[model samples]
Target: MEKRYVLEWLDRAINEFNPTQTQSANFEDHRFKSFLKEVMDETARQIAYLKKLAFQYPKKRKFQEVLDLYFSALNNLIDNARLNLKLIASESVISKKALELVLASLADIHTFLLNRYTVSINPDEPLRKYNLAVPVIDFAQPTDNILLSNHPALASLIEDEFDAVFSTGNLANITPRQAKHWKDLNDQICTPEQQNPGDEYFCSLELLLIERNFNSTKFVKYLTNRFTSHMEEYASGNSIEKLAYIQKLFNQIPVIKGLAYDLQHDDLSLTINNWFICEIEFRSRSNTGKGREAPSTATKSNGCIKKTADKVLCKLTVDQLALFFKAADQSKIIAAKSLSAIFQAVAPYLSTPYKEDISHGSLRSKSYSVEGRDEEQLLSFLTKLTRQIEEL
Candidate 1:
C-alpha cells in the first residue's frame, strides 16, 4: 500500500535489471548483473509473500496485482503463460521471456471453467474467489518438516545440523517491498546447517528426483526378482497403449494382492482393519467398449481416486463386483457431462455419511491399482532405497 516505497524498490530493481543510458558503462559488471537478478527474484518473492499474507486476514482480498504478477513471475520461471498474458499483455516483458507452453493449456482450462461457471452462479451464494496458486516446490514451508517430523532419532538429535540444511531465515519478517525465497522462512538461523556426509538434504527437485529414481529402481528390482518379473513392462508410463497393456495385466491377477498384518487385538479375539491402503489406477473404456478412450476421472479433490469408487471392485466379493460392474457399465466417462446423471443414479449407494464440508472432497485417497499399486509400495521401497542412495 506504500506506493512511494514500492516504486523506489521497483525503480532500483528495473535499473539493476537493464541499466539506463544515464548509468555509467562500468555498471555492466558481473556483481551488478547478479545484484539485478537478485532484485528481480526478490521482487517476485515480495509480491508472492504479500499475496499469501492477505489470505491470513478475515477480509480476504488480493491486492489486484498479486495474482497477475504471481502468475506472471511463474510464467517467467517455467517459461509458461501467465493467467491472461495474451489478453492483458501480448507483448509483456514477462510474456516475451516465456518460451514454454506447458501451463498455457492449463490456464486456458481454468479460464474456460471461470467463464463457464461465472454466469451460472446462484445470486444467494456468490462464487468464491481464489488467489493464484504457486507450485508445490515454491511453498515457504519446507516438506522436510512434514516428512521428517516423525523421525526423532536423527532429524531432532542432529538439531544444529538440521537447521543448517534450510538456507533461508526469518520469512515472517519480510518487508512488503522486499523479496525473499521460500527458504527465507527459517525456524532457526545459528545452526550447523552445512552439509556433512550421510546427512544429505533432499530439498531441491534434483534431490527429490534422485530419491524417486532410487526408490523406483530398487522396487523394480525387488518386483522383478522377488515377485513378478514382468512388472517393468506392466508398470510403466500412462500412455494409451501402456494403459491397455496394464489393464490386461491387472485382469490376469485372480485376487488383488495385499499383505495383511495383525494390527489390533480386542477383548474377545481380533479386529482387522485396512490401515495402510495400496490402490491402483487403470485406463478404463468409456463404458462403450472403447479402448482407453475415456480418461480416468476421479471425483477426488486432490486428484486421487476414492477407495470406495467403482474402480476398486477388484478387491470386493463376486456379487459386489457384479453390482459395481453393472453400474460402471451403465456410466459413461467420455461424456463428462454424463457424470451428473450417473451421480444421480448412484446417489443412494455412493459412500456415506453423504456429502462433505467445503474442505474434504473424496472420502478416500488415490490408491489405484491400474498399473497396480505403487504409492505405498514405493514408500516401502524407499527405506531400502535410502540405504542404497547413501552408499552411492
Candidate 2:
C-alpha cells in the first residue's frame, strides 16, 4: 500500500477508537479490544516501515515527509495515553495496557533512530552536524524537586511537555550568551555585600538596581521629598531634630525636586518613607567616620577609633567600594540597608577603640581595649567575617 494511504488509515483508526472513553468493562468486550489492539499493532508496523524509508530514500522529499507524519502519529498516540492515564485515577488492567503500549512505542522510536544515527557516530563530531535524533526537551533533567514541591500541577505539565519534546528530539541547549546573563544576574543578587549594606549606602543602591531596574529619577525624587518632609516635621517639633540637617542636604540635590510629587502620584509614600529611613541610618553611620575614616590619635580613645577605621577599610576592597557607589546611584535605601547589615554583622571585629576626643559619645563609653595578643583572634574573626560576606 502507498505510505500516504497507510498514514491516513492509522489516523482514522486512532480517531475512531477513543482510548480515553474505554473503561475496564470495555476491555472484556473481545471484539472492540481486539480491533483496537490490531490497529495499534498495525500503526507500529507502519511506523517502522516509515523509519526504514527515512534512511533508504534519504534524497526523496516525500519519504522524509511520510517519516515525519509517522512520528507525529506516534506522538499523538503517546499524548492520548498520557491523557487517559491522568483521567483514570484508579489504575486498572486497561490503563496498564495503555501505558505499556505508550512505553513500547517510545522505545521502538528511540531504538530505530539511535541505531540509524547517534550510536555509531564519533563522539568528537558535533551532534548538530548530524540529523538531530532527539529534541532539546529530552536532554534536560526532570525539573528540580523545589519546583515540583512549589507547584505540583504546573510541574506535572512542564514535565510532560518536556518529556514529549525530548522524546521527539525537538529541544536544544542553552546558548553561551544566555548562560552568561544568568551567571551575572546570580552574582549580583546572591552576593553577601549586595544582601547586606554594612554601613555603605552604595551597596544598597546596587542591590536595588540589580534586583529591580528602579527608575533613577524617581528614586532620587522620592529620597529628596522624604528628607524634606522629615526635616519639616522635625523643625515643627513633631519629630527628632537631629535628622533635619540630613533632610536639608537631601533637598539640595537636584534629584529631590519632584520627589514629593512622584510619591503622591504613584502611591509609593510608604515605600518612600521606609527608603528614607534606611538612607538616614546609613548616612548617620557613614558620617560618624567609624566605617569610613582613619581613627584619631589625640587620646587613648583615638587609638581605638583608628583601629576600627583601619579594620573596616582593610576588610573592604576596591571592587566592593565600586559596587557600593553603583548601588547608591540606584537607591539610597538599598545601598544603606545592605551596608548597615554588613557593618553590624562585622562590627564586633571592625569597631575602633573609643578615644575620648574622637569617640561619638555613645560608642566611646562602650568601646573595648584590644590587647596585642588579641590581634590573632581579631584577624581570625575578620577573616571569617569576610568569607561570610563574600558568600552572601
Best by lDDT: 2
lDDT (tens digit, per residue) of candidate 2 on 326-380: 3443566444444434333344333321111222332222223332212322343
Predicted model with the maximum TM-score: 2
After superposing candidate 1 on the true structure, give the runs of residues whose Cα lies further than 4 Å from its correct spot. Answer: 1-13, 16-218, 229-320, 326-392
lDDT of each: 0.31, 0.41
lDDT of 1 by residue, 246-287 (tens): 333322332222211111221000000011011122222222
Error of 1 at 303 (Å): 46
For candidate 1, the TM-score is 0.20
The lDDT of model 2 is 0.41
Cα deviation of 115, candidate 1, in Å: 30
